[model samples]
Target: MLSDHDFLRYSRQIMLPLCGELGIKTLAKARVVVIGAGGLATVVAPYLVGAGVGYLRLCDDDIVSVSNLPRQWLYSPAHIGQQKVRVMAAQLKALQPAAQVEAIPEYADNSNLCRLMSGADLVLDCSDNMTTRQLVNAYAMDAGVALVSAAAIGLHAQAAAFQPSLCGPHGNHGCYRCLYPIDSQRAGNCQSEGVLGPMVGMAGCYQAALALRILLGDPNVPWSQLWRLDSTLGEHQLLRIQPDPSCSVCGHVSHSNASSDDSSIPNSGV
Candidate 1:
């Protein structure tokens, strides 16, 4: 049952046909792990927290820098030298005091990724690099947790949801690795190609919306479909990602007695 305060706080959201009292309750019980505190996270975290997500674990090792000021709205000139996770946590707390926010001042890696995602109901990959994204994907797949991934660079942006468990028995949606094979090095990121605030913001907003839809068990949620946008051209495309049976990350791992190595995979700019 929602308390009087919660009822009032979320009155607007609860009024939506897709998100009634039950959806609000479900969101309140969901545990989410966000893998970055940069541009995408600056938008993703606050929305999830504001939506009443029960617990959000924010993982990032970077500190606020002048270069990030333009896109990372969560930080300001006063927070230039502060750790991203710490500053982001404080801001999220201020946004929604009822939401539990855990700030982990470290990058997601093999040693800690598993532990960081242990009890998460969902994982959001908002990291800017391909390495961190792949690492997050592997861990999420191993834990059978749903992952909402988004990235943007230059005038292009992309967002997708990889929910293996949520897909029915015959669902053939692919994991992140399946979509961008380990051998590919084509992803461009903000640092390399440069990006406008609105481009990154668009991807971040889509990630937040996708997360909410998944938590509410919305059947229309696009699983394994990559949403691509070229803001400069005013074009958008929804491409289905066909699972790769030969994929070493998701497919070949189980059939053969071997562990998949992701170290050689090139860095993605996103």
Candidate 2:
């Protein structure tokens, strides 16, 4: 049940069809782990907190650089030398005091991925690199947790949601590896290739919206689907992600919910 204060704070969202008092309550108890505190995460954290997510675990070991100021709205020129996680946490708390935000000042690697995501109800892959995305995807499969993965490069962005447990006995749909073959050569990154400032912001907001629908138990938006945005071209598209039976990460789960298609966007950089 929502308190009088919560009802007032989230009245608009509470009135939505799939999201009512029940949804608002779900939001109040969901624990979300965001893997990166960069561009995608910079926008993701605030929206989750503002929307009333119960707990947010922010992990990033990188430091802010003067060049990151343009797209990473959470940071300012004065915070160039600060840790991204701590700075992002402070800002997230300021957005919603009722939310508990933890700042883990370390990168997500094999050694710490499990600990960082031990109790996460949902994992948001707002990370900038494929390595981290792969790690998170593997963890999600093993933990039986849902994941919302997204990435943006130059003018293009792509995102997908995976709910292995929700996919029924067929197992699960494809994952990050299904989209980007693991053994493939590396792709460009923001440092080497330039990315439009708003591109990532658009992707982050899209991911946040999908995440909220999942958190609220809404199936209208659909998981195991891929969405792509071309901000420069002023357009977008949605397609089904084919689950690969050979994928080491999610192979155990079979997903026959929809026809398999190639919906992966080029990995220029994020």
Best by lDDT: 1
Please give the lDDT score at residue 188 for candidate 1: 74
Clashing pairs in 1: 128-270, 189-269, 189-270
Which runs in model 2 stand beyond 4 Å of their true positions?
Answer: 166-169, 183-185, 253-270
Mind sharing the TM-score for model 1?
0.91
Task: State every prediction's TM-score relative to the real structure.
Answer: 0.91, 0.89
Candidate 2 accuracy as TM-score? 0.89
Backbone N/Cα/C clashes per model? 3, 5
**Ten residues in a row with the worst lDDT in model 1?**
261-270
Could you tell me which residue pairs clash in candidate 2?
Answer: 170-254, 171-253, 171-254, 172-253, 172-254
